[model samples]
Target: MRKGFLKNRFVRVKLPALLFATVTVNRGLMR
Candidate 1:
């Protein structure tokens, strides 16, 4: 149960970071 909770937290953190990075790259390309 503890491991599952940690995995969920990791995914939550990682997903946003990944999304932010993608958006920044896309914006840079558009400019």
Candidate 2:
């Protein structure tokens, strides 16, 4: 149960960072 909780937290943090990076890159390309 503890392991599952940690995994969920990891995904929540990592996903947003990855998404932000992608959006920033796309915006740079648009300019």
Q: What is the RMSD, in Å, between candidate 1 and the native fold over all Cα?
A: 1.3
Model 1 lDDT-worst window of ten: 1-10
Question: What RMSD, rounded to one decimal, does every model reach?
Answer: 1.3, 1.3
Where in model 2 is the C-alpha error above 4 Å?
none
Please list the residue runs of candidate 1 whose C-alpha ends up more than 4 Å from where it truly belongs after superposition: none
**How far does residue 24 in candidate 2 sit from its true spot (Å)?**
0.2
Best TM-score among the predictions, by candidate number? 1
User: Clashes in each model (backbone N, CA, C under 3 Å)?
Assistant: 0, 0
For model 2, what is the error of residue 19's alpha carbon versus the real structure, in angstroms, after optimal superposition?
0.6
- CA lDDT of each prediction against the hidden true structure: 0.98, 0.98
Query: Against the correct fold, how does model 1 do in TM-score?
Result: 0.84
Q: Model 2, 25: alpha-carbon shift in Å?
A: 0.4
lDDT of 1: 0.98
TM-score of 2: 0.81
